[model samples]
Target: MATRPIRMFGDPVLRTRAQEVTEFDAALEHLIDDMLETMDEAGGVGLAANQVGVTKRVFVYDCSHIEEGLRGHIVNPVWEAIGEETQIDQEGCLSIPGVQKDTERFQTVKVSGQDKDGNPVSMVASGLMARCIQHETDHLDGILFLKRLSPELRKEAMAELRNAEWNQEPRG
Candidate 1:
C-alpha cells in the first residue's frame, strides 16, 4: 500500500459530495489500503476518500485512543444520534492542514457500516470517538469541520492553515 497526497481545504474536491461505492472490488480494497496508509503518514486519526481527491463514499477511522478498548474502521457509514448534542470541541482536519477550530458534535453516536471485507457492522461510540466518527464521515459527504465552527474561529485558524506545511513526501 502507498500513501496518497491529501487534498487541502481550498481544493474543490473536498467540497463536492462523494459517490457511493456500489462495487466492492479489488480497486475498492486498494483504495482503503491507501487511505489507511495516508492517515498514518499524516498522523491523523481518520481520513476520507474525498481527502485524497477521490470523491467516493468511503472513510476510515481508528479511535482506539479515545475509546480506550475499541478500535476499527467505517466504510460507507451512516450515523444515528444516541445522546444529546454536546459542546464544541477543538478539531483539526487533514484536508485543512494545520487549521484547527472548535466545532459542535454529538456526545454519543450509533454508526452502521461495512468492513473492508464487505461485512455489515454496527457500534455505539461516545466521547471523543463519537465526535471523531461524526467528523470523518462528514468529510465523505463533502462537509469540512471548519463549516461547523463559528466565523470568528474559522478566521482565527486561517493563519495557521497558511503556515502549515503539506506532507508531500511518499510513505512506504
Candidate 2:
C-alpha cells in the first residue's frame, strides 16, 4: 500500500459527495490500504475517500485511545447520532492542513456499513471515536468541518486556508 496525496481545500473532489462503493474487489482493498497508510502518514485520526481525491463512500479510522482502540475501514457507511448530549471539541482535517476549529458533534454515534469484502459492518462509538467517525463521514458527504463552525469562525477558517501555502504540486 502507498500513501496518496491528500486533496486540499478548494479541490472540487473534496466538495463533491462521494459515490457509493459497489465493487468489493482487490482494487477496493488496495484503496483502503492506501487510505490507512495515508492517514497514518498525515497524522490524522481518520480519512475519507474524498480526501484522497477518490469519489467513493469509504473511510478509515485509527482512534486507538478508545476502549479497545477502534480501527477499521468502512465502505458505503450510514450513521446516526445516538444521544442528545453534544460535545464541542477541536477538530482538524487532512485535506485542510494547518487549520483547527472547535466543532460541535454528537457524543455518541452508531455507524453501519460494509467491510472491504462487502460484508455488513457496524459499530457503536463514543468519545473521540464518535467524533472521528462523524468528522470522516462528513467528508464523504462533502461537508468540511469548517462548515460546521459559526459564520465568523467559518470566515476565519477560509482566510486561513487562503493564506496557507498548500502543497499544490501535482502528484503522480
Candidate 3:
C-alpha cells in the first residue's frame, strides 16, 4: 500500500465533515490499507479519512496498549461517553503536527461502527485508546483537537500553527 500525503491543518478538506461510507468495495479496502500505511509512516496511533484528504467517515487506529490485538479501521463510527469521569491529557494530531496541548476527554467511551467490509464493529475503550477514538472521531466531524483547547490555549496554538512549516496550504 502506498502512503498518501496527510492533509495539513490549514486544508479545507480537514474541516469538512466526512461523508459516510455506503459501499464496501475494493476502493474502500484500498483506502483503508493506504491509511494504515500512512499512519504507520507518520508514527501516529490513529489516522482519520479527512487527514488524508478523503471526506469519508473512516479512521484507522492502532491502540495495542489497551488491547494486545486491538487495531483496525472504523467506518461511519458513532461514539458515546461511558461515564461522568473525564481526564485532561496531552494530545497531538497527525494533521496539525508539531503541536501538543492538554485537552479534556472522557475517561471511557463506547464506540461502534462498521468495518471496511460493512461488518459491524464495536468496542469499549479507556485511557489512551479512548482518547484516540475520541480524537479521530472529531476529525470525522470536522473538529480539530486544537478547537478543544481552552480559549487561551487555542489562541496560543493558532499562533504556533501560523508559524509552523507544516501549516502551509496545499500540503506537501
lDDT of 3 by residue, 1-172 (tens): 9999999877899889999899999999999999999999999999999999999999999987667977889999999999889989999998888889999999999999999889998999898999999999999999999989999989988998898986656856
TM-score of each: 0.87, 0.93, 0.95
Query: RMSD of each candidate?
Result: 4.4, 2.9, 2.4
Ranked candidates, highest TM-score first:
3, 2, 1
Q: Which of 2 and 3 is ahead in TM-score?
A: 3
Off by over 4 Å in 1: 159-172
- lDDT of every model, 2 decimals: 0.82, 0.90, 0.92
lDDT of 2 by residue, 34-116 (tens): 99999999988899999988999999999875565578889998999997999998888988889898888999999999999
TM-score of 3: 0.95
Clashing pairs for model 1 are none
Better of 1 and 3 by TM-score: 3
lDDT of 2: 0.90
Model 1, residue 33: distance off in Å is 1.0
